[model samples]
Target: MRHVKDVTFHLLTHEDAVELLQFERAERAWFEQHIEARPECFYTLQGVAKHIIDCLALNAQRKMHPLIIRQRGVIVGRANLRNIADDHAWVGYRIAQGAGGRGVAQSALKHLLTEARCVYGVTQLEAVVAVDNAASQRVLAKGGFTAQKRLPGYSRVSGAPRDCWIFEYSPALSHGLAANNTLY
Candidate 1:
């Protein structure tokens, strides 16, 4: 298992795709476990699971950089550096339902952000998250990203348009954020 300190980020493969889909199934089962209420972003457990598979398939085929997080060699989450453009790129992530609240997300993110800056010479890194996903918002904040704006109807989740928060960070400004991380 490859690692960044204690957290490991695996390169997604065909086997990884199957594992992610199962993880999605587990995540979906979680949504039903609580009958009191559901999260606002409760759109698609399966679709989102499929979405990750699609992303990994394309990433593998094109050799685009992507990483899947594992703790003690168990799948926990994923993050990708996509949409590359002239020293800038967009980033996105998903933490398995059962894996929330741990520092795994932040650790993987720090590794990615640091790698983008030092190895890829990325000057700007941006991310757009559903406005209601406060957990993600906090992650971006702790990683030194600042909100740029909110885009109305930026994402269509579960057939309804939803607003999203746009956040950006500059490696030139936060040079100390990432260090000694390996690419999966």
Candidate 2:
């Protein structure tokens, strides 16, 4: 677990299934409009239980890091590093509707990056944002991600093809390499 300001970034566990389910159910409609639509099963208790179990298994295999974001002990969002391969991972995040526009996502992402580097030894991170998600793009930029390319028909949102902006973050590129060839 990591704390940033008033927000806490925690690894999701089996015990958190109920809380996660409640949060997801509460934000389902809002999330579906802004992010990719989740499978219908994802909103159920059974599905969340299975999802948590799967996330824990993936973490044990060092293939993914699923996290929950909390503020003052209340679950407010989630962030994850998925599809990890080599030294890179794909970054994804979501903030509750009431929690938007407060720099929460940016701060949580910054903390996640630190854990990614120290714990996972990840050197590069990638994020894909829907072309119309200006807020998410801003958060990525605030967290030091740079847009690399635009992928057309990259994903489906609400069952329709959507364009996406690919962004990348590399510690070696953001922080100049030292004479010892080590990331700062």
Candidate 3:
């Protein structure tokens, strides 16, 4: 694994709107290829501000946790644990196109898992990934999430029905982890 230095994942703040906008705009195309595209309004500063504000409000309510992934002070990605309830939440993450590989997704998943268990007291987490998105699938597996089942035509990617896999993190995965805390 490549050592990624100066990488940090922290709760989002109003001050992050500008950098977040830049990150989103820069990686929009890459992200859209795998996930649904964001609306045009989402590329604007005001839109980004509103997004941050909205997420912050939800965070305050403990309904969700939004985090900004940064590397050396620049926004590189975004991750969120949403729909938090009953000690469970949905995990979602996106890394900038330029920041792909170099273990960013794996690192971010680890950080989010840590926060889910530590800060949010969420014992279980789930993620839905497009069946063909192998990169994300590998990342989730590396983080101890096991595929539970496939949801046929569960999502629309690029306006077409797409199959998806439902993955849930298992505490047992932790027991099987090596001393370094990884399944491998």
Cα lDDT, model 3, residue 29: 78
Task: Indicate which candidate wins on lDDT.
Answer: 3
Those runs of model 3 whose alpha carbons end farther than 4 Å from true positions after fitting are: 178-184
Candidate that beats the other on TM-score, 1 or 3, i.e. the better one: 3
In the range 29-63, model 3's lDDT, one tens digit per residue, is 78888888888898999999989999999999998
Q: Candidate 1 clashing pairs?
A: none
Candidate 1 per-residue lDDT over residues 1-184, each given as its tens digit:
1223456886666556566656655665543332112343333545545655766776655424577888777777777888766688887777777677776667777777766766567768888877877888887877877788999988666556778888987755445543322221
Which 10 residues in a row give candidate 1 its minimum summed lDDT? 31-40
Candidate 2 lDDT score at position 101: 81
Candidate 2, 1-184: lDDT as tens digits: 1224578888998889999999999999999887788899988999999999998899899989999999889899999988887789988889999988887887777766876787888879999999999999987776777889999999888889999999988875555422222222
Ten contiguous residues with the weakest lDDT in model 2 = 175-184
TM-scores of the candidates are: 0.72, 0.90, 0.92
Count backbone clashes in candidate 1. Answer: 0
Q: On a 0 to 1 TM-score scale, where does candidate 1 land against the true structure? A: 0.72
Question: lDDT per model, in order?
Answer: 0.67, 0.83, 0.85
